[model samples]
Target: MQFIDTHAHLDVEEFAEDLPEVIIRAKEAGVAKIFLPAVDLPSVSTVLQVCRDYPNYTFPMIGLQPEEVKGDYQEVLKKMKKILDASFAQSSPFIAIGEVGLDFYWSREFEQEQLIVFEEMVKWAVEYQLPLMIHCRKAQNELLHILKKYKHDLVGGVFHCFTGNQNEAAEYLKFDNFVLGIGGVLTFKSSHLREDLPACVPLERIVLETDSPYMAPTPHRGKRNESAFVANVLRQLAASYQVSEEIVASITNQNVARIFGISV
Candidate 1:
């Protein structure tokens, strides 16, 4: 059974010690493709290196994470633009613009900056004709508001590690340009995703992710996560939908391919 991890941070330091073994384990567990989301300027080199090392299985998405948006955002954006321009000239090094969105859960100090940065990245995605990988938190309504303004420009992408209500899910569906990312959270007993998601979004509009080194599924809940652990999320989702894991994998794989414009 082939599977795709639509969101993961394999370039993070947590995987630095044993990245080779981790990749082997992921392949052993049936993960055929893994998408890496950039967090900041410092992470770009490492993310690109990972993609180069595992060219057949790993792909990179570049963007400034919302939490990283700050007073020096103008400088950061300049650096990001330079890298993006250089990357585009060499090869289509990135598949999407993401791990980008609004996050008010941490602190609202940089809220305005975050919004500005988010809008700029959205425009970049449009100019490049690339998809977006959104990371929204307490700012869902605000995020949706901005997305609505640029709805016509969006080429669609994954709402990475989605955790929202039925109404929010409905709004995302209306955009017709995204897929809700299901991950380890679905394995939690109290996770509303298991109970509320199936009723709101079609299975085809769902994609699987790990968001690794965080949100590890049960049986590995407190441990550092790896791409291989995505299987646990697939299992839980299959149980929730009352279907075979193969079916869930197949549906999600197709969704990932469609959104990322990747062949799998």
Candidate 2:
């Protein structure tokens, strides 16, 4: 069955030495497409270059990740806006504004800055009519508050690496057009996703991802993640949803197409 890794930081240094082989392995493992999201200003170029090298097999999204938010965020964002505009002018336009959102997992030092930067990214999505690849952590409440403001204007997006409870899942689904990005955490022995996910999110509202260079699935947990390992996530999702692997892939592929306006 074919699948899409809706979110992965393949541009990161972890894959620097053997990226070509990584792509080949991903194809062999049935991952048809990998969406690369920029975590900071520097990564924007790296992500785009990777997509360019792989062509249609890899896609790019521009945004400054919340965890990367710092005191100089405004300057970084301003520079990124220019690059983003230039990207659209190119033949291969970025598919989403992503890997962007609020993260309070490490510390709250940049909480206010994160919120402001996230809102700016949201506006870019609304302006460009592009889907979002959101990365949210302990600040779901704050993220939801900002998102609700542009609820009507948003085209669609993914709640990337979603490990939230049933109530949070339901709240996100209220957006109707968005989808949850289910990744390796689902396979973690200690994760509640195995039980909680099935009860909260329908197969159609979930898409598979690896968050590569991180969140590797069980059996490979603690090791560096890659798109090839996304298949493990797919298998676990099928088990969680009590459906065939093909069914999970098909429905999640459809969800990817619906949100990103791309067909695998």
Candidate 3:
């Protein structure tokens, strides 16, 4: 039942006091690795620090989240570029360019800015030959439109925390090297993923994630989430696909490896 949490925020304050315990519980629950996605400039350091502490057990990604884009985004990215270059030069590069994409969930005030930032991220991913960990919401059409240009150049990546319909799923899958990131949303009683997903998304093109410190599954619905809960996501996905949990874990782990070039 080994697993990989392809997306999570273990560096956040919620896990500050007991991150070690959280990692222990995740390992106990068979989560062999966790990928940490940076949301903003500060998180870059935090995510790196956590990955440094855990070494091979956890990996770090670099990118600016769309939701966090602001007036100073250009300056922030400039500073981050220096850090990214330094890491690359040192031979300790981040696993992916991630937590980056279009998110019009809250407001469209930064719509243009998000587009600019996302294009730059796409460029970064292509230039670095690293995969992307996209976080798209309410702007899939636009995101896909932009992504179409770079489809051939992208190495591979995951559509992190995917909760879209079948049509949207199909569109994202058009990118040969991309995979949909399945998470707690699939387990919600109200979610159509149980019915909708299996038909469109192939098990081999899917990966498990908790998106933790958020989106905990059914039994832990309203509570804080962690990598350990990816087991719950794995359970629901198995039932949805009518396969054994071991099958789900194996395929998803392979998907993670293919996309991010990591192993348990």
* Top candidate when judged by TM-score against the true structure: 3
* Model 3 lDDT tens row, 50-158: 9989999999999999999998999999998899999999996599999999999989998999999999999999999999999998999899888999999999999
Q: Stretches of candidate 2 above 4 Å error?
A: none
lDDT of 1 by residue, 1-264 (tens): 979988889998899899999999999999999999998998888898999999968999999999999899999999999999988999777999988999999799999999999999998998898999999999988888888888888889888888888998888888776889989988987899888987878889999899998999998998999999999999988988889999999999888878887756
The lDDT values for all models are 0.90, 0.92, 0.93
TM-scores of all predicted structures: 0.98, 0.98, 0.99
Candidate 3 has an lDDT of 0.93
Tens-digit lDDT string for candidate 2 (96-135) = 9988999999899999999999999999999989999998
Pairs that clash in candidate 2: none
RMSD of 2: 1.0
* Candidate 3 wrong stretches, greater than 4 Å: none
Clashing pairs in 3: none
